[model samples]
Target: MPPKSAHHALQLEHERERDATQGFEPKGTFGFIRYLEHGFPSSLVRWHYHDEYELHLTLESSGKVFVGDYIGQFAPGHLVLTGPRVPHNWVSIDTPEEGVELRDMVIQFAHAPLETLAGVIPEVKSILPLLHRALHGIEFFNISAQAHERFMRIRDSTGLPRFIEFLTLLGELARSSDYQLLSTIPMQSTDDDAALARISSAINFIVQNYASQFSMKELAQQLDMPERMFSRFFRSATGNSFTDFVNRLRVNKACELLMETERYVTNICYDAGFNNVANFNRRFLELKGMTPKAFRQQAQGRFGA
Candidate 1:
């Protein structure tokens, strides 16, 4: 498994509701794609996931990048494409006294429209392989400048021109070999929509409440599912047992604190929902391959702190 999965459930729920009520894609939009940009420390900067494939470009600042179970550093021009419902966030560690003006530029689009197009458009089908690979998130290298330029074109245009630029960019990315898959365990879901919805709800709950104690029994009850059945369903959907998933989320939380704060290891352990220092140390090492203190020391070097 990758180190951890991260999300903010309340914010994710809010985004879902907002999109449902107000709509994210424009009424007159020709394609499913939407372009968005936000600065550091903004409301958009949260650990959350949505039902769109996102091409994320870091325009300013460097810090921790969380994609599904993967945790690592990101600087300017760092580009990643994440699939639908993959929890992700980027926290800036080296912000100035005055925060950055524009920290991230993103393009989000749905999978269905493109898949539908590919039925008749042979060339459009080439990107499907790349889309499949993005189920685990892809970090692209050596093409940041081209990505930035193409993103600008896609953002500034509308209708067919924008769609053309979007395909052009995806084609470039699809053809490029300089990329790495971030998540070790791919997030594959069963065809049952109800089961997927339940899993999504459960994941949101875990993201919001990972700092506190919770039980699979309670969650299963809330979802009106049998404990054993839910256990099988969850592991099938997320590639980890319920308890293991939550623990990894907590470990990822610990990683964030270690990289971004000066709190003591014991305090961070508890803050990350670990009950005791010894267990925290062990789990941290098991997932991150380092003790908490050592992790913090190395993370600090990222900021020269």
Candidate 2:
């Protein structure tokens, strides 16, 4: 029989599937960037996307952050800027001992608003480059400390004070050169419609079949391309080899199961699409910087379990 963790993971998977089908629409009443401060393990903790630029600051805890096709680790004070319509989520690796009350400070604004404003406001144009770079997602590795302060001020202030602080933060980020683009390939534009469709189809297939063993040859066949040609295109589009991309997805699934279920590590290993425990452990450690057992222990500690 399948392990209990398998059933639990399946249920969570269904929830995420539903979320994706229904879509998440951010509601902003002020016609500007909306500010939100929320704790961990909330409904907002899911894989979803919206048509707005997102500036996210992790206030506490560490986890793996998924933005576009990029997968990486994140800790408290981690800051990221995601472009419009980019799919993203941050999964905390471990819960806090005292319980986390606030895990993220977020601000969401539309691209049109910023672009329109930039046309009339000469100073606003200075930050346009930063926004452009966000098409692939941007990680401000060294600006977390400074960014956190600005995020806090934006969170605590009201009215014009908050608005001004947000603009100031953007200006600061624009001037900073310590940021890195998270995604290997930038989102395709109108001119690359054909390429966009091809890559999108490939991504969808991967997301749907990540838990099963498959070959690049089979994927190429499905896309009606020769294996070598498809491989080159895939690598160019995702900035990752086919094997690396699959492993990253599997590792990410393992992480979610580790935190959300009480199943054995061995069960999680297979359920997450790894053929064996040893390989799963190796990959998990490489990506997460810890063993599966250690991750679970840390997560359990946060919940006082």
Candidate 3:
């Protein structure tokens, strides 16, 4: 028999081979977005990427989600928008013996047509920023009820009506503030060039210094803006309060540590910039719906570990 290390290496190689680029071409489709649904354990449930933005909604089962290099948990009502060619997969761990009948509902559309339309159609221009953010991956919260309804409408209709409903869905997602960027680095900006520059600077600083102690007041002073005003501006641009943003960065860092290292939870808490283990556990549970240890255990399933 092969050694354990050799077996694991072979397993990883096999999984990488499964991570092929899925090709899609719209055939007889009325509009840009194509709607698709499939059951758990189907051919669609693989680590893959394609040249279209995918708005994916998980309707059943709980699992670990992999987007780019981010690994996290996912459950019902989990809605994530992934940009073109950003690798992603959801491996359901809680499937029943017979498997789920319908686990995922998805809509995909290309970027070029949307960009072209935005050049002429003022209203459609609003979705540009959302598309840009999806380059990392955006997991929206609290809109699953509405999203499910819209997906059903898109699936049931044909031609222009379906296209209109799809637009409505895009508009809703673009406007929503309750979301988190999942992979790479979380970045947010506004239309104002000046504001975008300032926010970009602040985001860069935060991303670099997240492991150290810092304050919004200190950052505000550095920017020569009043604390209260800076606080509001930061929220407007990033969709998260300054403190919440820092905490999320720390939590995501902790997730990476838990997934990649064998270190103790206490050490990881401080390493991820949390001053205390209790607060680390609380924040992890609040943002992830699971404790740090639970998250680590579930993340292992992402690799078939």
Candidate 4:
């Protein structure tokens, strides 16, 4: 469990989700940047989405970062870009073997840099599609050895020069050939402003109840929609049926528990909400291309947990 003070601070941060008055109209030149240096023993979801495009640069860390439909290992020199309303989170479970740390910088920008208003501008139009692709997620490697210095410069500078330089680097990144799209599914329209609210609500439901046994019946009722309509809406919005989507979360959680805990595979399966050990094994193999034991062995070889 988190320490008392940290627990309260985290709760306060989580409560921000309850305020649904804010609209999803993309705002520009309004990104907030911050530095994060996390040591260990952290198990908080903070699984919220926003209108801002998030750029998180992992300085020196090895953990799993779940971005939209993607879940994989996150290591040093990794920079991930996620677009608006793509629910993501980083969970840090302490290692029982020696020392480990997770450190990174997160810059959340208002909407994407390319807006419909900028469609008329020839230059802006060139980069619009790339930015649109980010709605799913993007991951890049900081191959430039001087990246630390460049990051420091961006962090310390204050004013238009800094902002311009920042945009320039991002432009270079958007145009670069060395990035991977994390989610293959094209982002769907939540329709309009109300779509954002619905997406937010769905994410809230997932994060708050991932550990428990949840059914679409409850969610459909809560959203005040017919079961069929809610099911269709969810599949269209997330690119996965409700069952598959929740299974992804379960498998992701199982991966973390497998590596971080000495708990048996059967126990881990039960804890992650798997109905049976056999099913868990099958799904784990399907998604990870390995059985739970094999995955744990691999992670231990690399992370030595």
TM-score of 3: 0.58
The digit string of per-residue lDDT tens for model 4 on 26-109 reads: 233234432223334444345445566767766654667767767677766777778876666665443445544545555545
Winner by lDDT between candidate 3 and candidate 2:
3
lDDT (Cα, tens digit) per residue for candidate 1, span 1-305: 11123334313423444341232344355356787777777767776677789999999999988787676789999999999877688989999988988888888889999999999999999999999989899999999999999989988889888999999999999999999998767664444556656776787677668888778998898888899999998888778889888878899888888887888888999999989889888888898798888888887887798
Ranked by lDDT from best down, the candidates are 1, 3, 2, 4
Write model 2 residue lDDT over 139-213, tens digit each, in one string: 987888888888778767767888899899999999988888986667432235466556666766776688988
- Superposed on all Cα atoms, model 2 deviates from the true structure by an RMSD in Å of 8.9
User: Which regions of candidate 1 deviate over 4 angstroms?
Assistant: 1-52, 58-78, 84-129, 141-145, 157-164, 171-183, 188-193
Candidate 1: worst 10 consecutive residues by lDDT? 1-10
lDDT of 4 at 168: 65
Instruction: Please give each candidate's TM-score.
Output: 0.66, 0.61, 0.58, 0.63
Q: Can you rank all candidates by TM-score, best first? A: 1, 4, 2, 3
lDDT of 3 by residue, 1-305 (tens): 11122211111112223232332223554466677777887766655566678899999999888675456789999999998766577889999999998899888889999899999999999999999999889999999999999999988888888889988999999999999988754432223557645665676577568899888998998888999999999877666789888888899889989997999999999999999889999999998899999999998997778
lDDT of 2 at 94: 92
The 0-to-1 C-alpha lDDT of every candidate, in the order given, reads 0.81, 0.76, 0.79, 0.65
lDDT of 2: 0.76
Off by over 4 Å in 4: 1-52, 58-66, 69-78, 84-133, 141-146, 156-168, 171-181, 188-193
Off-target runs (Cα >4 Å) in candidate 3 are: 1-26, 186-305
